[model samples]
Target: MHDPATHHKPRIAISACLTGHSVRYNGGHKASDLCRTQLEEHFEWTPVCPEVAIGLGVPRDPIRLVGNPDHPEVVGTRNPGMDLTGPLRTYGEQMANELDDICGYIFMQKSPSCGLERVKVYQDNGHPAFHSGRGAYAQAFCERRPDLPVEEEGRLHDPVLRENFISRVYAYADWQRVLAEGLNRGALVNFHSRYKYLLMANNPQAYRTLGRMLGTLSKDDDPLVVGPQYFSELMQALRRCASRGTHSNVLQHLSGYFKDALTPSDKSELQELIGQYQQGVVPLVVPLTLLKHHLRNHPDPYLQQQAYLQPHPESLGLRNAV
Candidate 1:
């Protein structure tokens, strides 16, 4: 969703491990230059390491979950059950609050302290579950900002998952923009409108849900509903599903909308690029690059207004890539 030409950008929180920070328990870094080279030009990143912040020393014995999956907490098993519950929970709370502009989180994979998915859960008998429940710190972070996009680095390698992550990040940023102005159904509609095509691209169900929400609009009504929170939960659910897919399904879905927007010649040219991407001869961004270029001159104001596809100029590295 790079739209750097429009001067739109977002701020995000990412684990230090993903940024190549030596904040891991192993004293090594797993920096993602995908972020360093591509996204660095657009987003301002806030780095965090819950394990280190809780007084865990570098190269220390690793930690794991040790209770009910829902309520299980983190601890250093070899250190006679040193609990990191309090500090991690508190820090997550503060991090959530302090992150004024944060729209998403990119965490390290399989980290007992930071992994968002597939973390090894230990049983009472001290056996591994070989799956993730969630990390204590990451769980708290999600709890605090359920509307924010959260993805583990490993899952992001999946194109569908990656698209979903990107969609949610931009959508959350859109929500932030709406909140900054004032909460209204009009703002909500506007927010959904921008993301309409993007959702249609990834998840048809999500697109329809949003369409129904938009249908609820009433001129004299207050767009925001107070507690019992129907509207509130709706927003949360949308953000949660923003990332989920295989690129093939999503790309096929999205291409439908763009078919008529392109001329026969334009479609042919774009198809060639897409063929290259599908065959892995070119990266996924190549077709998106062309689609974005043509979208600028698209006759349909409605399509152009779907800002979610091209959320910010830097989304596709359009402005900064050159």
Candidate 2:
């Protein structure tokens, strides 16, 4: 399997249409400017259009999910008998098995074969049903690797979701690196320590739960068994969106490290910035930038090592909008 950590740009899988490829049924692209321009520098994208890859030609008949929302069949919109579900699922399983190094996936929204969520499902009468269905390939991929960070391009427009998705991608890549090198108790402990604050901001309960699990690791225990369990919990925790209160709590906790080094004015200003962030008066970048500046001046080893400080590259400017 390829290891993304070895590459300068983390590998990501994206819907071909989102990359401006003419792979849609209408032979057009649903290009995402952010993915093509802003995030292009940070990630090496592998575009996959399940419809196209499954031998559905360009300008092909449109398809829709029909049957139970939870287990729908992809069939032609004009001719319900023209089913394409089997081929799409086969292609998805093959892609999921092959793309083990992909750190994240960017799905095209509302696609019958790639949307992450809420893709339309039609009834037997050819009328639209509730929007509770996921794309066929997307469903297969999620089942294959639930730990991987997955998001729809449209949802990435939301600042909070975008930040969370990118953060998860970096964290997942780091976790994969640990597994690739060798999974040992010490490495796992160090990984958890670095992500302490980041995990707390996502879910305090999981932070404590995972810490306790790591604390109980024994020499007799198999790392392969324990590691999967830990990762499953970690991914589930990250899916919980962090709120302003949680972020403010984490920021305050981080500020304590520089309390002695900061002057009275500096301390007051930092607290004020954090307060503004908590009250939604400012984005997280404001206080985080100040903290980063202080960390440079004071140089606390533990604080400097925390992934919460720079979860992803600052060049991505993810926190600017958050």
Candidate 3:
């Protein structure tokens, strides 16, 4: 089993209000117990409140996104002309430039300055016209680091999204470590090989596309140029949540490696467990446990090396929820 405490915890950027800080416009906190308690052991958080950083006081008037949903202006709800968009964007850009070590971010949902998605955009007449706008700081963060895994507090409540977010965070950290060690064609290829099944479960098309990208690498190719493109695609691939069907496909593929080693009864039992998982009759942990059991007995080198079997720390119990 992977010892999480022995591994380096990924640095994560989190909204200050979510960390139990009284940084909200109403002078209250929207403390997420999950972040403060559950995830503390796994993540090192860097709390930030863009509004507060930009000189907005606690208990300040609430702000809203106005005008175009795609490019909304941030302004005080009580005073339309009181724009904070410029200051927030400036702060966001600065954070993006400086927070290069952050592997992921957790934003407060529906925040005018920090929401990840579906923040309300009001019309000139003051009616909420749409929920299509993203928060100013969140938008800037995305533009700056498209590779980073980002999630809203509300969305993280879902088991699948929560699992996916943590998985990506760990994966991104691993990629960062790889780059830190000096990325070369050989190192990149080895990295991709380890994540093969994981990428397939999330998005088979992207998995194949990335494989093709790896195939194009040459001894003379520049790691500096190729590394960015590879990671960009890898992150985008991971952004697509792994579905039951896709997971089943990967599981079945893994099972094939042990087909010759298993008896008729063992094979039947494994197939049934995978079927139950695909049908949502049981959590993913069931089939995965069985697979690990067989893997221990069989010990195929390829399957043993694959990251899909243990993407993140098991202590987190992420698979149990999904």
Which portions of model 3 show Cα errors greater than 4 Å?
A: 1-6
Write model 1 residue lDDT over 91-200, tens digit each, in one string. Answer: 88878888867878898887766767667778778887645577878878888877677888777666555655665676667666677788766666666666665555
What value does the lDDT take at residue 142 in candidate 3?
A: 81
Better of 1 and 2 by lDDT: 2
The lDDT for every candidate, in the order shown, is 0.67, 0.88, 0.90
Tens-digit lDDT track of model 2 for 1-322: 1222344677999999999999889989999998988899899899998888878889999998988999899999888789888888888889999999899999999998988788889887877786579999899888998989999999998989999998899889889889999998888888888888989999999999999999998999887889889988898799777889999999999999987899999999999999999999999999998998998899988887788888888888888888
Model 1 Cα shift for residue 138 (angstroms): 0.7
Root mean square deviation (Cα) for candidate 2: 2.8
lDDT of 1 at 291: 66
Global Cα lDDT for candidate 1: 0.67
The TM-score values for the models, in the order shown, are: 0.76, 0.95, 0.97
Candidate maximizing lDDT: 3
Residue lDDT tens for model 3, 1-322 = 3233456999999999999999999999999988887799888999999998988898999999999998999999898889988888888889999999999999999999999888999998878985579999888878988889999988988999999999899889989988999988788888899899999999999999999998987878897889889999998999888999999999999999988999999999999999999999999999999999999998887787677888888888999988
Model 3 is weakest, by summed lDDT over 10 consecutive residues, at: 1-10
List residue ranges in candidate 2 displaced over 4 A.
Answer: 1-7
Q: How many residue pairs of model 3 clash at the backbone?
A: 0
